[model samples]
Target chain A: MTPGPTPGPLPGPTPGLRIRGLVKSFGGRRVLDEVDLVVERGEVVSLLGPNGAGKTTLVSVVAGLLRPDAGSVSVLGTDVVRAPRAARGRIGLAAQDVAVYPTHTVEENLRFFGALAGLRRGELRTSVDTLLETLDLTPLRRRRARELSGGQQRRLHVGCALVHRPRLILLDEPTAGADPQTRRGLLRQVRALADDGGTVLYTTHYLQEVEELDARVVVLGDGRVREDAGVDQLIARYTRSELVLRFSGEAPELPWPGARVAGDTVFLPTDRPGVDLVKAVELTGQDRERLRAVELSRAGLEAAYLELLGAGRDE
Target chain B: MNRALTVARHDLVWLRRDPAPVITMLLTPALLMFFIKPLYVGALDRLGYRGVNGAELAVPGMTVMFSFFMAGLVTESVFREHGLNTWARLRVSPLRDTELMTGKVAPCLVLVMAQSCVLFLLGRVVMDLRVRGSLLALLAVMAALSACVVAFSFLLCAVARTRRQAFAYERVTTLVWVILGGTLVPTELMADWVGSLAGFTPVYWASHGYREVILDGEGVAGVLPHVGVLCGFTVLFVALAVWRFNGGADKQHWD
Candidate 1:
């Protein structure tokens, strides 16, 4: 958890990543509008957003690949725009695209990026060896990147970014098109990195990963921060569990209030599934013989994300 | 500078894995030099040099002309990073744009210089070519020409929007310079008006320096002006490249 040499005065113990009044536009279309966010040290923040929701734009701006029209981004107390080199030294960005040199072997790719990050002889070697083992790339270390399969290449791509053991890691959909094993390995590494006091900002369409990482989910939509909370908290606050009753034949009219029917199944949105299940059964006393199954559908991260995004569209 | 060298070392490693392009570039000129020696000898004879064999002009001429294709190798290396989607990764690293460009341009510089030295070695060993001037002066000309080619490649990378466009530009520009600058035919042997345009090409000065040392037996002092002109061209190309190169621009990597 040693901080790299930051070449400026610090404003106390700063967060790993901080953005305020951030704005970015492309061809007059605002992609990010007055956004504000902060990720503390040792925190793993999962950024959730739909396509075209400016998730990649935000990552690009933080990586110093694109200039932001407004606002400020500070990485580990260094302003990204003002001192890009200093900020960049502390950030490791694995872009959404699978980027690696096809001509270079897995080990070469790791070493090259490590050297660029100013890692020297023995330290660079140790980092590369550890990353190869962590990413399950040791056996394939000598294999050129082009020879690896899609999933193997994806793993190597992510491996190249963090080989320098950067302070702040930005993973933009690191698991896209990855196999189940690759995805799991990456998620585990991300969690481990965070647990070791390294900050991580991860973006993914897969909500399960967020829950798996126990990350604080930040749902972004319409160029603004919509929701920021823990996964269970979001589910609890934004969604309701449903008491579902499926009948064998045509669903009879339920006398219970707030009951909705679709295709012989009745749905009752409820905070208390046990009491509602009993009430639903009692209400369908005569039709109870035809009831095929009773189930409670608990809301999860996906439902909460949908509710948040849907609410965004409503406004 | 060390970071740039690291990148350069990375590029050199990749070159070792696939040495076909470098191998072809180095060997292509030797074959051309061997086949065109008689023509060069006749041309040199017509220019009032008695008993002069063709390697004097053919070796350096082909070396300078083919070095443009060597520059193409650098252009390809730059765009290959983009094509492989590695450019963004490099851009995201801590290296500055100049360092990244240096890393890419350094290996190609070595290759271009190697091509020239190898060609001259073959000329000496096989074509009965002798350098009456200082070898140090000849080496300086080669080094300056290599720098100019590398700079010109960066300018091509800066302006071309697509990989195909870069290749097309490289071929057309190289051939145009070859014809106008006296690589294919000495500017003296070309149409009389072509002389006015010959001095504008970096290759023209490169070839002129070679002639001074190899043909006229000029020492280091004799070829200094041509080397200076080549260096000037290098500076101008570098300035234009820096002005036009946009690291953020979305170049069409494949098309």
Candidate 2:
């Protein structure tokens, strides 16, 4: 099946999106505060934030849905505010909410949206056929959108956005209701898009998806971008592995920088787990025998996200 | 124009898939024609409407009245997109504001015409209601009536933020049109002040033209003035809706 536009080498060296000092307010409260972001082509950036963290506000500005009070937004080098139709034509947005037509059949919903996105009739049919198979919605193509279960509807929602094969996709919590299989398939398609030199800005609460896609993580909180780095870099910077020693008796006082005693056990957070463990054991002296068991907990992206937004925010 | 028609077809496709509009259009008119026709026939005789069968007056009048109820379907066509989470998707399409407005109003226009046909035909075949006026003049008036109501419905859809709000507005409009505009009872029978006020409602002009066609056998000469009034209301409502939508584009998005 023929794919949608390849977005290969767009005019004037257009990156995916370049946002500068964007700000938006609602009822005297700034929902997006001087936000700045840049996602180049062939990059998959996962935006992570708790509810009401302004992740929605940031992308909505880029998608040309809401105008920012200040700063500039450019999609593929075209000003989104000045050239809205041109910028929006290159962008596909799958919202946190399922936006497919409920009463229209699955096939109808996809083709209708694809046509609006300016897909030719023949190409639209082929692309839809491929999406139905790729998303595993082929069997339900004839069924009305409302007849699908939660998981099926989620896939259809994402499929509508992809049918146009947009160069830059801004997907917000696209995997919210998908089953495990569907989620995996959807991620595979996202991976394929990046591999095809397309750019993606994905927002999700699931850190596992970030890890699987190996996406660069950008965190939003308090109406601003809190952090932007590769997933591995974020995990390494924010969270360190921990070594816990369960003692049969009261553990001896350890001089390690991050060592604390709780009942008969000691919890130590260290950058070098092996070296710190040796130091702690040597310091235990005669109490070393009291160390009945040792356990190591590796740090993950979830830890980094918590460390970043885990401050005194209402989420 | 292409985008607008495509959007309109998309909406119509969904509306067809849902049985609610179809059942309401078919059943509601049939029920009103059969049950209300007899009551009006007796009631009109008591009220001194002796020259014409009450079914002819009641059917066209009630048809015009219930056509206002078509506002419900029109509003639903729009508000339901937001409910189903698709409004933002539609907005981002490469459509001009005029195209979007056309797309929105097109299906409502088609539906109102269909509804008029159903109610008028049910009166003719089922109740033996005869056309005393020029059929062409009556057809032109009905066509204008449909367009006027459709425009009113489109304005209501554009102004309403939610389904509940649209329903409330439609309810109030229905009451005003039925009581004040002579859709429920003859305007001549109402008090002098009420009759004077009825002249202001577009529905009064629409059904009043229907009365000329059904009772007085008037041709285009008689129906032209009423049709002109209906056209005026259509233009007024549509122009206001377009102004609201185009001027408030950012507000609609941020909302």
Best by TM-score: 1
Q: Global lDDT for candidate 1?
A: 0.89
Structure candidate 2, residue pairs in collision: B133-B217
For each candidate, the alpha-carbon lDDT, in order, equals: 0.89, 0.81
> Which candidate wins on lDDT?
1
Q: Give the alpha carbon lDDT tens digit for every residue of A35-149 in model 2.
A: 9988888788899888998998887888888988999998778899999888878888899889987778999999988888888778999989989998889999999888999
Tell me candidate 1's fraction of native contacts, as a decimal between 0 and 1.
0.87
Chain B TM-scores, listed for every candidate in order, come to 0.98, 0.91
In TM-score terms, candidate 1 sits at: 0.95
Residue-wise C-alpha lDDT for candidate 1, range A66-151, written one tens digit per residue: 99999999999899999998988889989888999988889989999999989999999999998998888999999999999999
lDDT tens per residue, model 2, B95-180 = 66677767877887777788788778878887888888898998898889889888888788777766777788988987897789
By summed lDDT, the worst window of 10 consecutive residues in model 2 chain A runs over A1-10
